[model samples]
Target: MSKVQKPEKSDKIDNIVGMLMEYEKMTVDLMRKATDTPILEQYDLNAPYAKARIIKEDGQIKYRIDEVTLTDEEKKKLKEIGELLIEELDVDIKRLGSNENAAAYIRKLVERIIKNYKIKLTTDSLDRLMYYVIRDFVHFDKIDPLMRDPWIEDISCNGFGIPIYIWHRKHESIPTNVIFQTAEELDKFTLKLAYMTGRAISIAQPVLDATLPDGSRVQMTYEKEVTRRGSTFTIRKFRERPLTCTDLIIYNTLSAEIAAWYWYVIEKQASVLVVGGTASGKTTTINTLAMFIKPNAKIVSIEDTSEIQLPHENWLSSVVRTGFGVSGSISEITLFDLLKNAMRQRPEYIIVGEVRGSEAYTLMQAIATGHGGLATLHADSAEAAIHRLESEPMNIPRPLIPTIDAIGVQTRVQVGEKSVRRMVNVAEVVGLDPTTKDVLTNDVFKWNPKNDTYVFYGRSYVLENIMKRHGYKHEEVMEELNNRRMVLEWMVRNNIRDFKDVVEVIRTYYVNPQQLLERVKREKMEAPSGGSRPA
Candidate 1:
């Protein structure tokens, strides 16, 4: 029997390159198999170079040639090529726009370098070289594919040697295959992310909290001394377009009745406070509720980080700043400072994204002074929220609490195997109990956990307050509520849930309520039977 000879590395490379050289000419399934895995489908075929693909895997995860696992020697070569590209290529990165354009530019520069150096390689080797070059210089390296996956809501790495986990929109938290096994590799990647945020991280300032290039919130620990587990980072991905009232309606977060109640309350310039636990979608609920604000109202929003997005033309968004440099040359601007300054702006509506400290006191005072205020707080229930406010750090006077006309309690409930966020209660602040000195709230709407339905309790002091404030008759207020509910249903029926579309309809309603009502009625009458209605 003749002994079989194992193919050498050079021979394998030559064979792969020769095969690729004729790949374009052949007419077959364009599927390229490497090892045992295969590239199932290309995301962007028109791009100048290779794009990512949905690997032929069970979990529907993605893979890219640039992000594939490499051996130690291959990594060393990739590093050498990356260094050479940085030294020889003087391409202006600022001129680049999208990731595709940047990748194309880098590929062209690399091709020139290869020719100038008289480098001879197969097509497959050339592709491998380009992958590392683009990954290090043009893209976000290993995490690029994760960022491209639209279903991911968050990316979290506890420390080196641990697999990265992602919070997917549908599947919830899931452990990914990607990981950094060494502290040096993890530290370098963390610093790269920090620099991308336009910030610095070091032993002196061993913490970083900043927004990434794509507006994702990045919070990191720099060294092992601070974290005790090497470097760590968490990225809360940003939604390109925020959720709207119509979206909440479709998601069953809130009923059209609750949304319409908020609309009428906001139109009357009443204050509202949203309370929820961490990751309970408090900010999202409030952001959707802000859509109820009159389009022409002058609005000022203050936050530690910029999150709220409104379609109003007369809006000013302000973000707090942290001190910088050795001596802290740049003064740190606190949320309290922003709130106090926002009051002087004479805004018709004031929005505090999240109140954590004395800023809550300031927000409450603003509401008491009759500034149509809206804010979110970390609490589980309405009473818990009030207790937090009246407690230390956020010591709002008990009497002044009623200035917040309504409190919306958002909760994350476990339904079957999944967790979902729901607006459990929309309570109207009735008054302070004279005997007990506690807040008296009338629950206008409450979530029934048994049936997973939002039930109307009809306890609406908010309507009475609106009547007193707007001087509209009871029947007129009821009619307005019914009409607005119909409009919301009409929007859901027509799938008009885009932020801009929802804003346009609401603004048009403000301009001509009768016309808008007539149009909505006509559409509702023409809809298929068994559609959703106000709860």
Candidate 2:
């Protein structure tokens, strides 16, 4: 039989190619016809891999994510091939660097497997198969589309069997069509999340608080250990491009006047504490206001989980590190530790993402030492914020309270049928009363609920101090405020809402105010009447 010589290498390669070609032909022949699901709105989250649709079902609006659907035969093949691939494929995913690179690597391996096994699949089917594989291995699997949706601010899964709810930018909290059908499924997903964050989650240590690779804040509990239900998770998505001061003005979160006032105070290196309830946009306001800090000033930011984003080149960002092995271990780094280190760094500005525990005292000390402080507090009003600071945990002395220049009270309130965030009060910390020993604050701006407008009290102690320090007369300061207001309005009108663009404009004004102001005036004059204002 001539020893039944094994197929030559070239012949073997040709055989694989021929087999793939034949499989492609078979798949083309077996292709099945593939939604008029009442889509109110639809958009691609990740083109070709996933899409999101706002649909109405049984009189309820729901967010539905549509991904590639496979036939039963294809699904079975995918499972078999995936198991084999996982067992045999040797890849150092970390060495791949990015999701795109890892995806390409996975695709190559899947293709090699298909060729070796002579798996029957068309090009389109292979593409679909690769998407699921990459999604499960490199992304968040079923919720990957939700993770890609830019309009979603928060995603929460209370437990297995419960529909995932997303906090949509336009629709508020709405249920999505995705759910974890079994406790084991959610446990696996929770474990995957922990692994992604380079942490561990188990029945012994169930709680997990971590920042995702994309900077989104995530808190999870594993396998019904601490939570009453199954594994639970809440993700607060981070914006790639942070909101600018102009964005707040456009959202009516604060008036342009308030923004200009903040610009003036921030330029003067005044300490500000933004206080609000949950999801009231406190951190957002501080992050926006931080852009007004002089471009060259040395700044340090400390956070439990990184949320503050700035455009300053001379900025240092730090986040608390959870300890390994046990709580309060030496390896752990707390906000208090970071704040102390920030003081040693001699930063001109110290930004605390949120002042919750003992770190509040360190921040107060930094502010007292004349480091410009920016922070957020979970409180309803200026008084409440002061009380919290002076109480236990924070325990900031009354004398240190006045070291904070202003308290911006932000709140989310109902406007018509929708909830809107507004800076309800901008109070200047005048000082502690000699007799009463109470922290006195002058309300510079107060939001009027009736007309949905902000009323400036016509006088700001903070602005007055700024004027004195800068040697500006009252009239000159007022004129300067108007100029800044006009500049901000011009930016809003010109749609210069990008964080970096806003920073450039502010920096340009600092370098050459006349040049920028003249440009703004010229643009305003050249525009058609009423066209220079934002709609």
Candidate 2 Cα errors over 4 Å, as ranges: 1-38, 532-535
Candidate 2 is scored at a TM of: 0.91
Give lDDT for model 1: 0.81
Which residue pairs overlap in candidate 2's backbone?
none
lDDT of 2 by residue, 1-535 (tens): 5678888999989999999999998777656311334668899998977899898766777998988899998899889888978887787675788888988888888889999989999988888888888888888889999999999999999999999999998878899989999998999999989888877888778899998888898999988678888899999999999999889998899999999999988888899999999889888889999999999999999998889998888999999998878553759998888988888899999999989899988888788877898999999999999999989888988898889999999998998878889999999999988999888999999999998899999789987887787788999888989999999999989989988799999999999999999999999899877665454
lDDT of 2: 0.89
TM-score of each: 0.84, 0.91
Q: How many times do residue backbones clash in model 2?
A: 0
Instruction: Please give the CA lDDT of all the candidate structures.
Output: 0.81, 0.89
Residue pairs that clash (backbone atoms under 3 angstroms), model 1: none
Give the residue spans of candidate 1 off by over 4 A.
1-77, 88-105, 121-128, 325-330, 531-535
